[model samples]
Target: MPEKTIPILPCRTLQPVLDFYTALGFEVTYQQRSPNPYAVVERGGIELQFFAMKQYEPAVSISTCYVLTDDVDGLYQAFRAGLKETYGRIPTRGLPRVGPLKDMTYGVRQFLVTDPGGNCVRVGQRTGGERHHGPAPQETFARALHFASLLADSKGDPAGAAKVVDRALALTDETPTRVQLLQLLVLRADAAARLGDEEAAVTGLARAAALHLTAAERDQGRDALTRLADLRGSLRP
Candidate 1:
């Protein structure tokens, strides 16, 4: 017989935890309500066990897990679609939002998704060296976007951010998803504006505006519109 270890995680309530996993394509294998709550969820060959704790505070909890997979981007897309389907819109900054896929310094391409119970499940694919070749082109672009974000927001280097995005843009062509193209353009515009390059900012905004957007994309661009307006105001003579 082989020994398999399944994590037993604590949750404030079992139902939300169940719902979260269910949305991510997991099925409830067993559940109990009376005499202390507990449940088991399984997806593919992975299994998770969750227990209810009335005093559990997810905000202070330090529960985390790593889900290694060969198709990290595909699973991430599925999870993103599931989250949006369940929550109407994916959360931008909180538990339940999926983080962008990144190539860690430790040499793995990974993304993080925090469950309702505040459990961080990192989906990763081993890369770098003969053990694995490299991530797909889309994954590389995703990693670049993540780096550009840190440069723009954390390091406060908009020029560096613009350069990172420019490198990604060079790698991409018309085959890239409209969402990716739009996001890259928006980020570039933001970086240009922060660099005091009004012409470049205006040009990037115009390019983004020319793209045919879906209803959801239009709604998502509202924030971009506000930023564009502010940039235009600053450029007025």
Candidate 2:
């Protein structure tokens, strides 16, 4: 027989916590509210237990667990689609979102998804003998945006995401194309809002809104605007 370990996490509310994981394809196996508040959820053989803590603050708490998967990419894609379908948009600035996959130096491909309670579920798979050829500058910037999305949306660390996007923007060429600039500004606005910096968020959004978009850039701009609106709406009042 094999031994299995399940993570016990704390959440401000048990029902919403259960709902979040359920939306991520987990099944609620057990739930109780009268006996000090507890619940259990399972998906693909992974089980997690959560307890309710009335004073738990997701922004300040540091709790995480790892879920090793045999198909990291597939699982990420499924979660991404599920999130988009449920939320109208993949929340990249306040709520849970699937992160970009990366081949870690530790010899595994991995990504992450944080529950609404700020419990990080690191999903990883062994990448035996696989080498990562560094990406080009544009590709690097794209990866940075993906990482920022994960930090802001999944980990509830918009401040951290802002730092990553800032470096990405700095490394960008001085005379970047309109599309490139638009993307960077949009991401900046998202991170700012998540960090509760309304002025910065407005400034970034204004800059992005003023950009002159080409026909192709118009399509991307529309999507970015929707994301920006969602991010702004989620900001603490």
Candidate 3:
């Protein structure tokens, strides 16, 4: 009367897959290399298994899974600390990277994590509040932020996300809110850095840092501020 499904993804090799999850505080439960290379990792209530495939390429991998966490922010911090300690930095691009937490237009607070095998583990926690039903934000920049976040973070297309943010900046006639401007600039910085445009990233981060915010705005944008700091850290040697 019950069902539990564990994803079995393909990896170019088992050690990398194991090491990546291990760095994220996952414990190795089962592993084998003699007959067929396979390994399983577990953290809290989540579990993932991997099998080796010699011809597999992580760049083109399309495998993914969804994981719901009750303590999304706390879990994120743990993963962040572990990854930084293990790899010396929290990777923001390419395979085996962790994404910043975001509140989506669809009423979810989530982040994307790609393992060494390119299997994206989308981890999220439903935010507090009653669901509000209404048409999407009509303003250009607000709309662009939604679309750009999906493209850049969810779909892993930094170049496309950068284009969306640029178009919004050029076309928006209405002035954006302080938080809106901050989010847009931070997202721009992320897209730029991932695309290997360090100058643009620096400019965006500086602009975001320069914006004035009241107590309310600062409290409201606490998460974005945290993400902004992460982006800035990424540029450091």
| Model 1 TM-score relative to the real fold | 0.57
Tens digit of per-residue lDDT, candidate 2, span 1-237: 798888999888887778778777889999988869999998878999999888999766578988888998688767766776676655554445444455554467776677788777889898776545333236666667667655764556778888987887787454456766676687778767656687998888778878878888877555465555555444435
Candidates 1 and 2 compared by TM-score, better number = 2
Among residues 3 or more apart in sequence or in different chains, the pairs in candidate 2 whose N, CA or C atoms overlap within 3 Å are none
> What lDDT tens digits, residue by residue, belong to model 1 across residues 1-237?
799878888889999889988888889999999798999999886788999989988866678878788887678768767766776655433454455454554457676677778777778887765444344335765677667866864354789999998988887353446666766787788788667787888898788768897888766654444344434444455
Query: What are the lDDT figures for the candidates, one per model?
Result: 0.71, 0.72, 0.86
Candidate 3: where are CA atoms >4 Å away?
128-134
Q: Candidate 3 lDDT, tens digit per residue, 127-181? A: 7553442356777777888889889976788999999888877764677789988
User: In model 1, where do residues sit more than 4 Å from their true spots?
Assistant: 129-237
Number of the top-ranking candidate, with lDDT as the measure: 3
Candidate 3 or 2, higher TM-score: 3
